[model samples]
Target: MQNSPKKEFRNDEALLDIQDRPTFFHWLILSIQHLFTMFGATVLVPLLIGINPSIALFSSGVGTLTYILCTKAKIPAYLGSSFAFVTTMQALMKADGYPAVAQGAISAGLVYVVVSLVISRFGSNWVDRVLPPVVVGPIIIVIGLSLATTAASDAMLNNNHYDLKYFAVAIFTLLITIIFNLYLKGFPSMIPVLLGIICGYLLAVMVGIVDLQSVAAAKWFSLPAFDVMFVNYHFKWYPAAIIGMAPIAFVTMTEHMGHIMVLNKLTKRNFFKDPGLHRTLFGDGLSSVIAGFVGGPPTTSYGENIGVLAMTKVHSVWVLGGAALFAIIFSFVGKISALIHSIPTPVIGGISFLLFGMIASNGLRILVDNHVNYELKRNLVITSVILVIGIGGAYLQLGHFQLTSIALATVFGIILNLILPQKARSEK
Candidate 1:
């Protein structure tokens, strides 16, 4: 596959295209910006599932590098621990332990591999037919909106109770981010999210919300709690575990497509056509397999990083690579990891407030850019159903597996689009 040519932009533009390379200083800061953006969600998945957060950080870095290599550095995306598998993985961890969960992760990766092979053989035409703009737009919207509650909960609530300090910190951080994004020039303009996070963190520190005890207790350096498949844990195939986890791959795959579509719209380049969806899928799948072997949670394209890309207009794969490196390095440095972990929830919530809104706005941009005729009842139905199902906490359960939120909405949207007549009665 040929690499896309680097697009030139003026210094005043402050835009870093996919193939563009920033200066060393700019690169480091930009990369750190992404690190801050993805750290919370990536580590949260493992923490929620009772796994080692450091391992997730390490695997996320490795997984991102794998994805970069597989996509030939053409797609500026980062892979991080996926939240979609949290419930199933938690159950697997309880029932069959980490071994079964690892096997299940590998099984899920294989499902992506299988799907990628099919797409490679048959091309992605069917994918287009299955997920048109009408369906994809709202799915993207749902993906962002679905996370709204999480953001709000983090910003406004502490242990499910209202916290004035958290609310103030969150609002203050968000305002700082907005001001930077709107009024800054050149380099500062591109890093509003990072700046907001820093200022918010300081505010959190002043408010006594920042806990540094963990950092003080942490060692300077340490190895991640690795659980190598063959070395640390014996490989065991549990059909029930595989059955429980494998189907979730389909769910994440749809989310992956939505992320890719978001990137396409943001970058104005068709990555699916360039690096080929097959390559992207292979990278993502292989990353998950590697994560499984190493005891990290399953990895997928991260929307937080995507939101940073959108906000900063920095799409350099090199910058993303640098973030991956930091993740790996942080995984080994106990104090550093502890310090990052100590960042108050409100700070993260504050950053997410802007980032998630950017994602939702991009979805709206898709609808507008594609000129989707909302006047048509067919289009209206597809969009409406996706939004309701995706944001309303709707879910579908089959035996041991459950499909919920954005994934369920995507499936329903696709089905509705296919069944509904293309030409429908328009509103008067």
Candidate 2:
């Protein structure tokens, strides 16, 4: 339960191990920090898809707890609303309705359960052999780069012309984040993203850009609305929805691995080797299913939470438990949810710019750390193909099902790796 001797302490003199549980006050403070780190991105899934934010928050808390239990309290991750299902869910809802989309997510979660069982029975060697650093690195890069346009759009606020106001807020936030990360020390340095957000939010208010009228009118307490549940809708068991949703799970599983890899690096713990990939994947899938049943968006490990782990150096499962509890409590408080939604887009844009870039950088770091040789022809081919197909928006459509760039790259890399022969010198 304690930290490994190989743990990299942020401060050489002050080491905080996983087992070195903090006081109640300290735990609360750290947990609140985790809350802020995840809150900005977690609610966006429901916000974009026109679902109740309270339900998303509540489900995220429950989902995270479910993951923790499934992993035997070993993995420190917060499962929240996934962005992967955004477009597909929208299309399904428009075509078939919300009930159909919910059914699709449930089907996808079932697919994860099957994949997890396979890994659990046969072990992760098959996965590692097929999707090693060479393959996983570019896939992770694609996960971040694919979202580049969305990040830029949020920051720029204009596709054709420059909007100096929003752009300046983004830059200001970015600058403060850099300063907090590099120049500052102690607590402030650990929560640079949170600090940057506070600064940007204040600036946004000064410029008269923030709108808090909704917060002012919102009730103090409210329950989640479950009117869109699959059971509530007529004919929710459409075969087409299940067919379309099941394949999306394959893509998400790849992203799940990347998230686990990043967590491994951040905490200096080989979670895949410890709790094992089978358990982690099972937990993730179960969380997704749990979210779907509650009328929330499908859940996945939050990359923003991983970023928080990397920055804060606080790797305690109890802290995550506290965050989950806070989320659950906040879900019932209508005003709190409104306040979270009121945070201007520019602030989120500025923070996401740094957070998403860090994710891509970590992917590259994985390559270097693992000694993935670019000199080998097979390696070069694998890397180039994955990066291009993943970032280029290439799609593999089968009937109504489709695999996006990351999923395609993962499949292609595994196939290419297994088939390509190892050669020496010039041939390599």
| Model 1, runs deviating above 4 Å | 1-14, 425-428
lDDT of 1: 0.89
User: Which 10 successive residues of model 2 have the least lDDT summed?
Assistant: 6-15
Would you list the clashing residue pairs of candidate 1?
none
TM-scores of all predicted structures? 0.96, 0.90
Q: Write the per-residue lDDT of candidate 1 for residues 1-428, one digit (tens) a residue.
A: 12345344222232877777888888889999999889988999988888999999999999999999999998899999998889889888888888888888998999999999988998976777887889888988998999999899999998899999999999999999999999999888888988999999999999899988989999999998798899986555788779889998998998999999998888887778878999999999999999999998899999999999889988889899999999999999999999888988999998888889899999999899889997788998899999999999898888778887788899899899989987755544
Q: What's model 2's TM-score?
A: 0.90
Error of 2 at 215 (Å): 1.0
Best candidate (score: lDDT): 1
**How do the residues 6-78 of candidate 2 rate in per-residue lDDT, one tens digit apiece?**
4453223223444455667767777877787788678988878877888889989998999999898877899
Give the C-alpha miss distance for residue 176 in model 1, angstroms.
Answer: 0.4
Best by TM-score: 1
Off by over 4 Å in 2: 1-20, 158-162, 227-236
